[model samples]
Target chain A: MSKHLLTIIDYGMGNLHSVAKALEHVAPNFQVEITADKARIAAADHVILPGVGAIRDCMAEIRAQGVDTLVRDVLASGTPFLGICVGMQALMHSSDENGGVAGLNTFPGRVHCFPKDALDVHDLPMKVPHMGWNNVYQQAEHPLWQGIESGERFYFVHSYYVEPQPAYTIGTCHYGPEFAAMVGRDNLFATQFHPEKSHTAGLQLLKNFTDWNGRL
Target chain B: MPLAKRIIPCLDVDRGRVVKGVNFLNIRDAGDPVEVAKRYNEQGADEITMLDITATHEGRGTMIETVRAIAGQVFIPLTVGGGIRTVADIRAMLNAGADKIGINSAAISNPAFVREASERFGAQCIVVAIDAKRVDDHWEIFTHGGRKATGINAVEWAIRMQAYGAGELLLTSMDRDGAKSGFDLALTRAISDAVSIPVIASGGVGTLEHLAEGVNLGHADAVLAASIFHFGEFTIADAKRHMASRNIEMRR
Candidate 1:
């Protein structure tokens, strides 16, 4: 089997260590390197954008490292790309966090915070940052969902969620209201939940991504 | 389905090894932190909380190593608490691959530290650990592993912590710690209802039924216990089964 180089784009944000370790655990044949170098990322066999913290800081650092355009270029080139947490949110057109910030606009959507007065189905006031294991319902079939059931639970820890166009949304989860959980088209797959921290079901998703050949 | 109430297995680490004590006294060896954490992960634990019970500053290094070792293999949320006092401390733990940094005494000494840490590292990763002890009519915050009292009302402090940007609250009842008598339901409910952020009810979980009560009665977003899980009295699956039987949503 040919070796694959999986470059985890590190713009000085997010949990790169855990993500790299997870990828290494699942795909022994793939070489995982965490780097902010544009050349290394652009030349890799696969790319992952892992992010956390605020969108403003994420976008600022991403742009500072010149990864914003590199990510767009890489995704457009049909290179398999994955985004997690804020990395996924940064792909949207804008976010309603930190007084509103612009994103890469890779997908036509906006990221919005859970309503201040949001309430769970139990009529109890819902908490922000929806931090826990929640069911991720597959809205559309995709290669990443292979070997993973539709209603499998994944760990989620974020307050703002993406509102992507119907054409780009592949999965949905509910906290206060139904929101996009996984979004992608062709070779690009991004998730608001962290697959690296998610247990068995999450490892399966990463394995599927590693095995994917960037085909629909 | 809504978000399932989480079942977290906490491992109190003292100088690189896992230890447990009743009511925060008589500390006894449990096992390796990494091995214990991995075991819990395999048993379908929703999350793991590693409390660095090591009091010395040098012991912090070992805790970091433990966190790194666990994060490399265990694929679940890991929270590292105990003696996290500075922004540098928070950064070090997070860099060591901890998903969240649990701050206790620091939040009491310097309230602004919570704001500063949250602003620097985002609220999602900043967990304010409030140790509370019941005092007559109300609960008061305690520090130094339930040794020192801060004279701060637990409910009021929780509200303040939320205002200062705590993404989550790990509310532990000091009086109930390791008592195996179930949680302080009144204390848990008071803080859970006071804050909009998720609250993980910690301390005093002896049986599977107690875990369910933490959610059903305490109204906690998550339930945490150390001895019950570490001593092998109950597996995480058993807790989930009990919770599910009680009609509480669980990951399953």
Candidate 2:
């Protein structure tokens, strides 16, 4: 059997190693490489876009390396693609983080700051950058959530969320009100939560990604 | 959802190799930081804290090369501490691929350094590490690699650190350190109560129960240990299972 190749796109924001480590843990036989090379990215069986930091900086680095073209090409090839945290937000049309910077636009949507007013009313006493565990309500059937129960907890650490069209939204999580927490369309999947940081359930999610045949 | 308690494994790196000791002495060579970090990552460590135990006395900066080396192998939130005295040092560590930079002796020397680092970097990037010893029936902050006493109460100092913009406190009980008995519950609770940011209890965690006690009784957000983990006395998987059975919120 040929080994599966997993390429984790590194754009120099934060903690790219953790994502690669998680993939290796879930799929030990799979080759995990954190690369910025466009050729390697194009040839991978699975691609992971992992990011941390301001949207502007992330987009700038992606553009600088011409990864925007590479990533789009990989998606067009119809291989499994997963974006995590800021990486997920980077798949949108734009983000409000840095005066509306352009994103990969693989999915038609805009990322915006999580509303502070809603948090205040919930008396959750949660600060911005909602840095902890939260329950995710599965809104639709998706392979990524395979073997994972609905309302299962996932680790989250961000203040912005991708507000994609309802057709692409697969799950919603309530910080103040229900917002898109997971999105999927054909071979593309993204989550605002840090599944690598989420623990066993998270590892299982990654396993599902690597083992999935794109049958939802 | 309630905040889940984090299970963190601490690596005390000396000259690139990870080492472990009981009570902070009688150290034993563990393994390569990269190898050990990969082991812990496979076993499901919520986060990893790397401290360059010899960086200060070496008269050099934090171990960037070692950090970068391990960063490629281990894919978990790696928090690097020891010899972080300046913002430039913090930047260098971050660039070397550290998720968070922990400042102990430096933050105590200049309290404003906490605010400065927190302001320049995000608050989440700044972790204030407090090494404390029980002296005169009080937990007093210790410095200079836990060889000198700051004469300040640990709880009082923790509150002050939060005020100065420290996002979290890595509180280590010097008296319990390397003892392998358990954490100082009274001391851990005192610091946890005094600060709003997460408190990571370090020192004297020997068993899975010790980790649970530190979280449930000590009110620690996370528990860090070296000897028990480094010596293979207990794996992180067993620890998490034990904690989960005891009704402690952990990533299982």
Candidate 3:
């Protein structure tokens, strides 16, 4: 069996070292590298795109580094891929953050700031940025959640959400109303929550993604 | 749904590794903060607190390099405390990848620093750390590495700090610290009741049930401990399992 190579694409928005360090800690034997190189990304067995901060700055860095073409090529190869936070938003067609920005268009959807009306009265008094832990609702069953239980909470720190097609959403969380939290189609999977910060459940999710056979 | 209570593992970092003891004595090597942090991250710690116990007493700067090193590896929200006195220190730590900065002796000495920090960096970025010890049958605030008594009531101090713009209160019981009997429920409940902001109960957590009891009876928003977690006495997974079995709302 050949060893899996995991490459975390760094576009210089937020911290990439933390994501790389987490991957190394979890799967020490696997090859983990934080790279912006296009060829290395294209040649990896699995691709991970992790981002933080505003969508405008995130996309700007992606364009400046020419990571868009590299990421598109990796997905075209049909290898497994995972996107985290703004990385997941970048998979959609566009985002309403920073006066609306175009995304990679890997999936059919748009990311927008969560509507105020969808929030419950208890949460209405809460502040923006929605920083903390929230419960996630499983929209559909997928191999990535094989061992995880339903209604499991994940650490979230974002005001924007991805409005993807219902068919593509694997799980939803209610910060305001039912919003897409995790999305999967074929070998590609993305999450709006920070799985690395979600503790045991989050680690289990990452383990599931690493062990997935890409059958579904 | 009610806001879920948090289970936090605190790492007292000294010279790069984690250490723990009662009254801050007989320090034993815990483990690499990075490695232990990763384990807690995997075991379901709601948050991780890295307290640089030596930074302030030794008159050193905040451990930005150590924080950056840990931040590079752990994906959980990281809170770094000790030796943080100025807004620049907070900014440096946050820029180094800390999600929040904890202020202890500094805030107690100069109350206005809290308001200034919160004003410049937002309230959510500041965490006020209070160490309380019983004196004359009344809980009083202790400062300067738990050596000096401030003659301030714990509850009153908590309320005052919140009014000064502290987003969260990390209250520690100096009397019960590292005792492992359990959290000082009296102190926990008092501070939790006094403050509208989140209160993280610290000191004397031994068993899994202690955590649940702290939240249910003490009304603590989170529980922080060191000896139990540092000495391999209990893992976060085991703690959460016990909490869940008792029907305590925890992030599984």
Candidate 4:
């Protein structure tokens, strides 16, 4: 595991410890570093963008720290990269939150809020900030989906949902209707769900990330 | 995706050790905080809530180590409560690897604390734990771990907390705390209906069915328990299966 340096990009907005702790737990001896330094992020064998706060502040700090271009470079380097929650949302074109904020725009789409009138099959108000464990139905057979069965529940805590292009959407779930739960192409994978908070299914996903060779 | 009803296992720690009491009284030692949290995480708990019952008066600082150890191995969302009164305190907890910080007495003392903390850390990491009991005809809020009554109405306070940018509310019925009768459905519904943020129904979970009722009847977004999960009465997986069988949506 020492051969793999997994760098967790810290833009001063995420609950960083839990994600790093989980990754270390799954694969001990892996040199896991949590940093905002572009050199460290770019030099690591793998990169992860994880966040828990507002996307606006996240993007702001990412750009303020001059890591926005750094993130683009890491993705272009074709390393096995991942994003969680706001990290996944930050890759979009823009968000309607905080009275409209620009995103990194790596993927061509807008982050939209779940409809207020959204309801589940039971008519329960599909609450905003859909905070709880929900299923992540795999939309494709990618390396990140290895060993994990479809419809496995993963924890999520966010109000806004990303509307990435269908070509990039690798997973989908339903609150009112189907939305992108996960997006992946080539070596990159991002999840609206928090693999760190999720138990068994989540552990498998993290392990898969460690073993993934950035291949389809 | 539909928010799967959460099953949270709460550990009420008094002096660096997990303890269980009947309505915050007659304490009995449960187990190590780190090990118990790890077991719950492996059993598929949606989240882990650790309440330091004694930290409000003279911080012990032991729970920090407990949180560090638990977060290292648990690999799940850990929410820590008790003695979190200020922004600095919240930062310490988050730095100690707590996914979210739960504020009770401080929020009651100064409602603005929630707003300030939300502004500083965002609403996603802030949780307001409301300890309420039925007083007269309505549920009245309590502080100091259900010992002192604030005379504040439960539902109104929940609504206000949401307005204060509280991401979630952990509503515990003091009268039912440790009684394990079941969750106070009326009180839960009143609060959950008043606030759009997810409300975690705590206290009075004596049976497996009571857990399901917390979501189906009480409309609680999550059901939390200590005695049932800690005492080896039922596993979190068992509760999920039961809830799913009742046509209640859950992640099994």
- Weakest ten-residue segment in model 1 chain A by summed lDDT: A116-125
Which sections of candidate 2 miss by over 4 Å?
A: A1-12, A20-49, A54-81, A89-137, A146-155, A159-167, A172-180, A186-188, A196-216, B1-3, B31-35, B56-73, B86-97, B110-121, B134-140, B151-167
* Best-matching candidate per lDDT: 1
DockQ of 1: 0.79
The candidate scoring highest on TM-score is 1
Ranking by DockQ: 1, 4, 2, 3
> Candidate 3 — which pairs collide?
A18-B72
lDDT by residue (tens digit), candidate 2, A33-133: 99888788888889998876667777888898887887778778888988888788888988888678888888888988867555221143334455556
lDDT of 4 by residue, A160-199 (tens): 8887578899888776656788998777789988998887
- lDDT, residue A109, model 3: 85
**Interface RMSD for each of the candidates:** 1.1, 4.4, 4.7, 1.8
lDDT of 4 at A205: 92
Q: Please, what are the lDDT tens digits per residue for candidate 2 over residues B110-133?
A: 888999887666566678999999
- Local accuracy by lDDT, each model: 0.91, 0.80, 0.79, 0.86
lDDT of 1 at A153: 94
Which of the CAPRI classes, incorrect, acceptable, medium or high, describes model 3? incorrect
A91: Cα error in model 1, Å: 0.8
Tens-digit lDDT track for model 1 on B1-252?
889899999999889999999977899899998899889988999999998886579898888888889988899999999998988898888888898989988889899999999988889889999999999999999887788988999999999999999999999999999999999999999999888899999999999999999999999999999898888888899888989999999998
The candidate that wins on DockQ is 1
Candidate 1 deviant stretches above 4 angstroms? A1-3
For residues B97-137, write the lDDT of model 3, one tens digit per residue: 78778998888789999998865655556889999998877
Per-prediction DockQ comes to 0.79, 0.18, 0.16, 0.67
